[model samples]
Target: MIADQPQQTRDPQAPKGRPTPKRSEAQSQRRSLANSSSKMSRKDATRRQREARRADMARQREALAGGDERYLPARDKGPVRRFARDYVDSRFFVAEFFLPLAVVILVLSMIQAGAMQTYVLLLWMLVILLIVINSVVLGIKLKRQLRKRFPDENLRGVVAYALMRTLQMRRLRLPKPQVKRGERP
Candidate 1:
């Protein structure tokens, strides 16, 4: 029977065509291949990371300034926030003038006359009160509108968000106003 089969014999000392790779060696080669696409020095890696971060920030700022919903951050995303922003933007709120009004009051308070200073203080207080009252009213209206528009939305933090947006000068609000003043939301 042994003689009937094709004669196949090998010299034990003869070299095989190629060595079989060890399991560890094969795994290491696979890992190297998988990770070999890019190789950078520490400095280059750091510089690349910084450039990426700066580009991201620039995109974010552009989105905020241009009212580009696609690139807006998580907090500014979604139709509910967009409606809230538009609602606040479409109206003229006294709080929107708070910064400039405060500056005026500060200048007035610096005047030499005691009566002028007293009047400036009163004016400052009056402006603050008006701003607070306006914010409260704006918040109430915004909440009602948001509830009507987005019944299932979480109302938490929305009032504050709308009020804060209202307090910002129209020209300075981030996610810059898409609607002009007096436009319906």
Candidate 2:
């Protein structure tokens, strides 16, 4: 006699196990999911994105001009850097005039008149000497000030940072100078 076989039946309310879906159905599901995430129209989304970018740029510009630390670049962040910037800005340096002096020297060198080249050479040497001397003085002063004010702060690259800042024209420096000339940082 044949043995009576027991048939397995899935419960109607149970989830379907590992069924393969058709391509069209899968595509439809993906479309629905993508649509659900962002309900706004494309134009509206783009407008919002543009506005966000504009707002961010405005904040950064303001930070650069006003010396706001939070929005400043990584290199310019922290009290150590702020102090360095202020220190550089408070005093005049020969390095700041290097660009203008170089332009003047260039024009003078272009003149072929007798002794013009000689004077231009002398001016160049003088300007370079003054800049080197100024940089040395600025470095020494900045190091002393940094040591005094930021005793516990890491001071790596700070002297270089201030020296580089000194090279840039004051009006063009990023995180524009907050302290007036001759003011103590």
The number of the candidate with the highest TM-score is 2
TM-score computed on alpha carbons, candidate 1: 0.73
Cα lDDT of model 1 by residue, 1-185, tens digit = 68789866665555584567789999999999867755566569899999999998999999998978888999999888888888898988888888898888888888899799889988988888888888888878888888888899887787788888987898888998999989998
Deviation of model 2 at 98, angstroms: 1.3
Per-structure clash totals for the candidates? 0, 0
What are the lDDT figures for the candidates, one per model? 0.86, 0.90
Name the weakest run of 10 consecutive residues (lDDT summed) in model 1.
Answer: 9-18
Q: How would you encode candidate 2's per-residue C-alpha lDDT over 24-122 as one tens digit per residue?
A: 999999999888877667779899999999998899899999888888878999999999999999988999988988898898899998898898899
RMSD (Cα, Å) for all candidates, in order, is 9.7, 6.3
The model with the greatest lDDT is 2
Q: Which residue pairs clash in candidate 2?
A: none
